[model samples]
Target chain A: MNSQNVFMGENLQELTVHGKKEFPIQYYADELFRLPGCQFPLHWHTEIEFFAARGGSIKAQIGRLEFLLEEGDGVFVNSNVLHSFSQLRPEDRCRCPNVVFSGELIAPADHLIYQKYIGPLLSSRQLPCVILKPSIPWQNSILSCLDRLFSLMQKHALKEERRPLPLLSFDSPADDIPCWEMQVQNELNRIWQLLISHAGEIPPVNIEKGEASLQIRMQKMLAFIRSHYASPVSLDEIAASASISKSEASRCFQAYMNQPPVSYLLDFRLEKAKQLLSSTPDTVEEISRKCGFRSSGYFCRIFKRRTGASPNQYRRETT
Target chain B: MNSQNVFMGENLQELTVHGKKEFPIQYYADELFRLPGCQFPLHWHTEIEFFAARGGSIKAQIGRLEFLLEEGDGVFVNSNVLHSFSQLRPEDRCRCPNVVFSGELIAPADHLIYQKYIGPLLSSRQLPCVILKPSIPWQNSILSCLDRLFSLMQKHALKEERRPLPLLSFDSPADDIPCWEMQVQNELNRIWQLLISHAGEIPPVNIEKGEASLQIRMQKMLAFIRSHYASPVSLDEIAASASISKSEASRCFQAYMNQPPVSYLLDFRLEKAKQLLSSTPDTVEEISRKCGFRSSGYFCRIFKRRTGASPNQYRRETT
Candidate 1:
């Protein structure tokens, strides 16, 4: 698997244990170029993330909300929100600079800063993500900060290459101070302050007990789907995995995923089949069965409708 | 107030509040290019720091221990250890890449990573600083990690300048993920792990109660000196502020700073006088009095011996 793809396992609830246990900040600069009809799969992590489009336009999905970010546009994903991105045009490549860091980088839970700002935003259900449009004053401020930070990081790297290799010595200087690192830390804090202050203007998401429980159920159902995607699955089984009624499962998926349970299952199966088609030389009948499709004819019909291409064609073009 | 100079006030104890209230990770990258006799003043901060020599050689003093660091040499300063730096030669210009961050960045107080590794190393009296020389395998590994991290930071920054700005829209796709951020986080973690594992190899420092109390008293005396540096102060008053005997104060200064209390005071006064001479147009007599010198003749004598020039000549040359 490409390291660029953050998804590690079949599960949608991604436990993104970023960095090592001692260091928890994660950073990535990825150029995402997708063929038309190809979608990055949905997954969620506890780390807060910022995704900025570097070239062309891309569509980002945070929960059920969709945002179309053109070049220079960006978005912030709050912790544990289901989100993904896709290139808007088949012919255009979408390059994005993305950063994901543990909220602990902002403040520890016991600290006043965490309690006053970061805690409220993280716990709030309504502000799961914020769209950073360059046109909006506050959002534009954030984009500029992000841009400056990225540039500084680049300068630091360039300096390393241009500088001579250090010689070894046992004598450590006591007056060595890190001025650039301080600048980076200051910039990140400024960005956080902007986000925390703006979070106050947005209405709090009133999450009812029933709604909260439903979200948990949906997560459980999604996990079930991921694990059983290649096997024969049904709405009854999905609902049973979450200990919810079949109707409730279907309603929950429809509400959050904007698709019925069976439709989601079918789409997931088709996505798996498409992957198999491109990566493996399995016959259509074998691929269809392996991906939980009943027959090659039905698989072809659904794949064509969703991807605008037959399974064989997708494989040939993408491969 | 050159930004490169980390010293903010006259107090020897620097309570470096890094980042913001909500974030406390302070970072700085300072390049030290000094003429012979130029020195970064002695100071201590609660934050931990890493200093890597980029070019030439410099002398670093931490507490009573002094080390001559050649290019590529680095050192880690544990929390609250007095340290200073000076250029090794009149013609040499030393460029160092230094990083200072809160120990909290490694792990919060409640975190196991802190309790198991960071906390012990920080609170230990013996491990106030560690010299990182390329000749030592573990230290060399740490230097390599630091180099990699710096390079990665540069890459992230450069990517921003190389890419075009993003445009905004509401139709977000589901495929954009940050891969580079993850890479950075991973590298930082690797560095932390190496540090933690190697920390066990060093012996624990045994601190005596008398020595600890002497340090506290010295801090009090230093604070008093900062507050009264511009006044007609004496050794008796400085010792009285810390409720210690004058001889004891002198002994403590000699032990830790490698100078008598009065000598430290004179050097400090001369440093202040130099700053005033260059920045303000006050007459030499007035500036000498303001810096707590008894007479212009004595001040000129000390300044010439220390800085290799008379007050008027130094001001004219520097200005």
Candidate 2:
């Protein structure tokens, strides 16, 4: 595989494991082993994930907690809880990106992922969502489970060689459940099975259920801005869509997020620009266009202001 | 002493070395023994500091650079650059916090603190900001420099006790430069020299050239909300105090921050309430009032919807 493609890949939709379809989910050693220095954004998938530092250490941030993982230590993040990971250590040997896929490569419901796993994890502050240094026994068992899950995923992928359609289904319910690593494994596997058995559709987003108020309307507006951040969005258009007066929309937004809606849009665009700069060798004009800046000059100015270095200087320094 | 107060202690006015009132400069270390597991936040003081971790590993985010502090590794951050640090390995010990105070602290412009050390370090992208393990010859010298600097600062603190008044009254230019640590033992000896020379007073918050928008008005609004969240904060009142038209203020806020000003207020309040529920032993009603919720019932409904758990349930589960 081209190493550069791994870093600069844009078609995030088509990633797969072995032969079976890959959906974002729980931790597997194989996936981690497959790619080195991989990173993911702050997001939640339909499957629970445990992050472990195999060789060196990895830093995982979930909500307020930040975990610095040593070898054999792991943090189990439940489904639909926002999280991000990075490995910024020098002595690390196994620097493969750690990610697990939810079983919903066949069918998915975002809510099930959240309700069953994330809800429980979040509700139970008792179980440190951010855990480190598991007992040797527990670590070995968890590692074994991860290996088996990886093998199973590989087996499903191998089936594609024999049958272009659905692969041979495993019958035993005992076999259906992935072996227990932690108590969470059972629920995690169950949700995975559900998602796997019925994967192939986008889940509905959450709806705000409250009295019709200016604030509630504003939340919808904010969500819209987040969803359409990649595209060119306008205040009048957003105001009309959110069914509020332009002035009122602007007012409500400023009061909540601290900046004007347009300014937020600009900031978000600039953030994307910075990301592209570091991760990809995209040109200033291209980045600006992608980020919806009206002019490269404006983009450069904002970029420099936000980050002391210019876009080009930053790209050169990092890349 | 309250452990939690470690972060806010003494209002450490400026960075110093050996308590002498001079500008802060970066120190390079060749052994991890002196600087291990140095975890710090991304904040800058008047002085610029550089830290090179030797024979140990660290991970630091210096501005945009996510540095892997390998042996002989170092990263130099500009004064007031917000950054954070974490240990990379189990063996790495915590490094002491580094600071770079302003040249205006005691010395003249073009002083060694800013010119000789930081100049070369900042410009060189090839040099690792943090060293993991330094080569043989450079290690001893670097360690000695750091060790002496530490002792010098300690000595300077001692001077503060013996001579509280007229502390900066040393007459001779020769006395201005001492041979305590490194090359600038003289400047390092001016412990509280600037503060002692001038009467006790906080420097006015000046608008620095090329500084980002003060964010003063926004901060004031947020602070007001935080302090009096339980009380009513009308849009007109907030706008009047901030010196902006209510509509303009709201629009500016929304355009920049993405949420309506009101929703932001609600969310910030709710977030605090959630934290209190998790961290403190307060009752739901008490938390509700403290968090600015209209009533316990309203708080419960909103809390449940936002967090998928009741306040009591959340508290119980978290605690």
Candidate 3:
């Protein structure tokens, strides 16, 4: 929320831990109507995510596969998968809850329990995401678990302001639950037992590894450009981050971000220049240098072109 | 289940990882009437355990705090705490479900979420165990979570023999949950949120650190004697494991196991010999050396005295 843009890391990782180190999971509910494009852009995190469109319809894409998540329907994304969510009708309401968690919370990586059961699904190259419809039985059972899990999140989120939950410590009698810790673990293990037992039966997504990795490298190129924008970031440096030729890097930027490398860099620099003008007391020359422009005159011309106002005028009006 | 004895480790730790390293939780149901003397002897585990008596009343002691766990009631034992459970009446059936888990499952130890909310209750020397009855509201909520959790365990345990669970990956959709991974983590976090909110009101147990450490030392001593039984483990070594005098060590063995240290060691060696006699082709002299009985004559005399049969006769009958 703090960053104005969706910032992927240089290695194309989301870099957020997702949840606590112990039980890697986190909950989120978003209204797409408020977002810049009524969608979260293409980004990949190592943690698997469950995205549900709770209100109206939404468009989702995992790798090259694109589909609409009908209201009340959800999708299960695999780890290291590139995915995005958007409102089908951004003019109206489109709300969603994204639940992200690591597979490790179900089982450890080293154990045979994990390898024999959980690992196959995560590392399956043939599958990237699964669409869950309520009409199906086994999928419905999975949805039911998720319903309880997320509904609890909604309820807790609502009550969090007023409630100080009961701790397990009991010197005298308090009204807290006695053994919830046991129940959560038990439920999760059982849920895993249900999922892995029928993994082979589910149809494959047929998504290619190369296509996914291409988006990943594209993201790395974007991240490299974003981070080094204040310095004189080059086409060579951007290409090297994703390990591609310079022309291939330009082609990636044009394909994914709809701009050539230099244009995107200029847009990024202009955005930063505007931010600095409003937030800092630096002079025009200092701000230009800080934003990676070789000359203040060039910076002023680009700033006027992008915003129809000089940096100082834009800052003055905004402030 | 594989080992015939309750094996603690040399560091006074129970080395079992409990559940998968990712989750660190496991479930067990025991019938105390089936156990020796209708009781599980005193042992300290680093993981926290929830001991609930489902069928009959049972005696439970966490650290110095000893009490009865009435039928339909449960107790929460903190980590690294010494605790024991036994039937209040050995003649009748006593069934219990013991849910053991690491605190990491709630939140990682290093996080502020864990330190501020969960850690205080765990590291508090004044608290060891909390008793939970059905009458208290908050405590009942805690028990409800446990009930649901354990009920799922019992249900899954039953279905596990027959049902194959659905995997999340769906190409043709034979039916699996789309987002169960999200739910499990969501549920666990919500459960933690509820637990920590009411911690301050729970009464302290007043169990001293010195007393808990004594049980800890006693356990290390027992583990030392058990692991080194095949060698010439002396009283000095046993005493040193617990950092106590030889007389004090002897007293602990007598108090806890209801025997002197040497007597317990002899019984253990004989048990090992009996197992080897039936399982292996080792001669009496080799068995004697392995059991640390000093000589075949002494080993034979002790074996006969305890089992009322010669080593060969016992081996013949058992085999």
Candidate 4:
């Protein structure tokens, strides 16, 4: 990926679409311990997402809100909200299976059902994220539907990404895929209505001016780092791109992303180096210098420590 | 139900809504032999409908088309199509479970999903009704969804006529209801997409100017009968209402409705008497007079023979 173009030239908003436009959803069975640094980086997209913690506890940080979601518990993160999840303890060995989807999967924006029930809930200043638990009845219903939804996706949805699920047509000749599209839709509808019914009790997220602007500033800084990750990136330059002081940029990252600005820069650099190693036949020293690392030895140490594999080992396994 | 009003007098359109407007759908587990005269008269409504025959064979007459649908066989009637079901043979005991719903129940008219997919199919001149048999794979998929939908409705929907199924609300406090709304919607969506995929294989019903006019003339004649059934309607007047000869009118009725005009009037009269018997304090003679039967004794005989109950016995049992 070209660093400047792939970063969208400081467009700031995350450009990764969760699923295909026709039937927009991506079902994930994520093992947290398997991910880099035992956590995926904080990112925000236009699509909404739901994460159900499984096997062990995990801490979900959405915007400025942070909470522990245990097994049998889940969380709903609203659209355009920056969020991340990580193990509660370093060795938690958690699994957090989830789905990320555009709202259009359930109802188009012009639909009456969307206008009456869905629009208000989505645009409300109060609900950036809602934590779900089995103790509550309505929340339990939502979680139960999520469970059923995951199972439905696992059963019928092909492992291939971005293709339309073989829901109805005999064209693809996958007989195991029954009429799953509609069944999954039915579960989603129930979950949405459950959220509607509890709109009042869920506290407002306080995405007032201060928090919203902080998120914008954070995005600009991240965009700057992404565009410049192939070269040396400093906190001073990142802060200058967002027109904020270096300390303010650090505060913005900490507030919305639950990490410091330098830590993010390091992660981005390491991520870019891994991409180069996997996609290109470049030497280790060449990749390390191109990814803004001080030395190939330091790069290899950090890569092995974070990913539990040497660069050559990763390339061999993946290639 | 008033005779003139219940008949929707000269409107020619059936006015009985299958379900509520907000969430429109009505489910029926119809035992064919229990229905008067072993059939319902030809009726046309704007909403679409689906029926799966169980236990024995029954013939479906849709517009000018007629076919036998056996157990594990189903049919889909498009919007505004006139259709009816009857025992293939009088002794063939059968149960035809079905759902009647407006197109809006599946997708709002303005949605892209509706405009791109659902609208074309419902308004297709080629597909008045589709027969589904378990022998074909795609057809069997649709039939399986119908089976699943019926079972979902049976489990989650209250026995009440028009109430919204207990889809998500805890307000009504029925503990057994789960998230069934989306599951049923999923099945319906798959069924719709299957029809779309098989659009080429399905033959158009030849609803050309000739056939369309035949249906219109038939409707006008039925409307005439609906308006005048309680006042001793004659075949001649029925023919004159739509400016056709008596024989042409009989042919039109048989061609579209699968029965003669006099039989329609007779069944309609019996239907009116049954309503009056159940809803009014009138004596059997009074109902017979109101429904334009020749005499109370003649009315009683016809009612007992058609419905397996005398007028007085039906009234007493119902009241």
What are the models' TM-scores? 0.50, 0.29, 0.68, 0.59
True contacts kept of each: 0.08, 0.00, 0.00, 0.06
Q: RMSD (Cα, Å) of candidate 4?
A: 10.2
- Evaluated on CA atoms against the true complex, candidate 3 attains a DockQ of 0.12
lDDT of 4 by residue, A226-313 (tens): 7787777778999999899988888888777658888878877877777788889999999999888988999999999988999999
Each candidate's DockQ: 0.05, 0.00, 0.12, 0.08
Best by TM-score: 3
State which candidate, 1 or 2, has the greater lDDT.
1
Ranked by lDDT, the better of candidates 1 and 4 is: 4
Write the number of the candidate with greater lDDT, choosing between 3 and 4.
Answer: 4
**lDDT (10s digit) by residue, model 3, range A1-319:** 1123344243456665565675566666666776546767666777877777776888887775788888878788888877778888866676576667776666556544456566887887676888878787777776666665555444443244342322221112222344333333344555465566557677777755477677778777767876777788888998998999999988777666557988878977886787788778999999999878989999999889877998889889878
lDDT of 4 by residue, B14-37 (tens): 777665565567666666676655
lDDT of 1 by residue, B165-224 (tens): 122111122122223333333344455566666776654545455665777777777777
| Rank by DockQ (best first) | 3, 4, 1, 2
lDDT of 4: 0.73
Q: For candidate 2, lDDT tens digit of each residue in B254-284?
A: 5434456687677767767867887888889
Interface RMSD of each: 11.5, 30.8, 8.3, 5.4
On residues B1-319, what C-alpha lDDT tens digit does candidate 3 reach at each position? 1123354344456665566675566656777786656777666677777767866898886665678888878787887777678898867776676667776665556544456556776776766777877787767666666665554444443244342322111112222344333333333455454455556667766654467566767778868866788799888998998889999888777656668888878877886888789889999999999888988999999889888999999999989
**Docking quality tier of model 3:** incorrect
Query: With candidate 4 superimposed using the best TM-score fit, by how many Å does residue A272's alpha carbon deviate from the native?
Result: 1.2
